[model samples]
Target: MTTPKTNRKSGFPAVHLLEEIAQLLAEGPRTSNELVAITGYTKVTCCTRLKQLEASGQAYRVVAQASVTWYAGRKPAADTAAIIPRQPTVRDYPVIGRRDMLVQAFFGAPRECRA
Candidate 1:
């Protein structure tokens, strides 16, 4: 009878990869591409591990424009606060009257407005 295959060598490689990724993240925040390059893992694998880290609260992601950066540890309250989109102010939108005046000035009044 053969003994069950139980040994450190038989352990899941993914777990080791997770530890490596966690160690890297502990040093500082990094993007998925950076992780892929450092760990020699495919982008899909790196992103999968990152998602697992996030789900476990061992890491978090910060998305800015076109890139996403991953950081170690549970996400900070300050980070979430910063991520909350601010309410739009009146200045954010140009008044309809002002826009119409500017358009008319630039392109002349519509034919309907001609005498």
Candidate 2:
């Protein structure tokens, strides 16, 4: 049987594309079309790079709508079956103690809120 074509490209192609795409995602989630505009790549090339990033676990996607997928960089997974983000919760805001309490006590009340 003939071998299927792998998406790999030689000469740091994935590295260059990965960094660019990661920067774009760091700014905000972007669709493949948006990436094409920003990276000056064709739809096929952009899609290819996106797939590579997802497979490598350096990025993740969210279905923003019926037909659109927004992609963003993720902290790379140690082992890549899947990566689940740690959801924010009330527990994350547990009260602080010690020096903060002393400062607050000395202040005798919080300062006025800024505009």
Best by TM-score: 1
lDDT value for model 2 = 0.67
Residue ranges of candidate 2 with Cα displaced over 4 Å: 1-15, 74-115
**Which residue pairs in candidate 1 collide?**
none
Q: Kindly list the per-residue Cα lDDT of model 2 for residues 8-111, writing each as its tens digit.
A: 33323434776778778778877888887767656887788788888876677766566556556564354463655676665565544434678778876565
lDDT of 1 by residue, 16-111 (tens): 778888999999999999987777767897798889989998999999999999999988985688889998665676544434778889988666
TM-score of each: 0.56, 0.47
Off by over 4 Å in 1: 1-13, 78-115
After TM-score superposition, what is the CA distance of residue 115 in candidate 1 from its true location, in Å?
76
Evaluated at residue 38, the lDDT of candidate 1 is 78
What are the RMSD figures for all models against the true structure? 8.4, 16.7
Which candidate number maximizes lDDT?
1
| Candidate 1 lDDT for residue 50 | 89
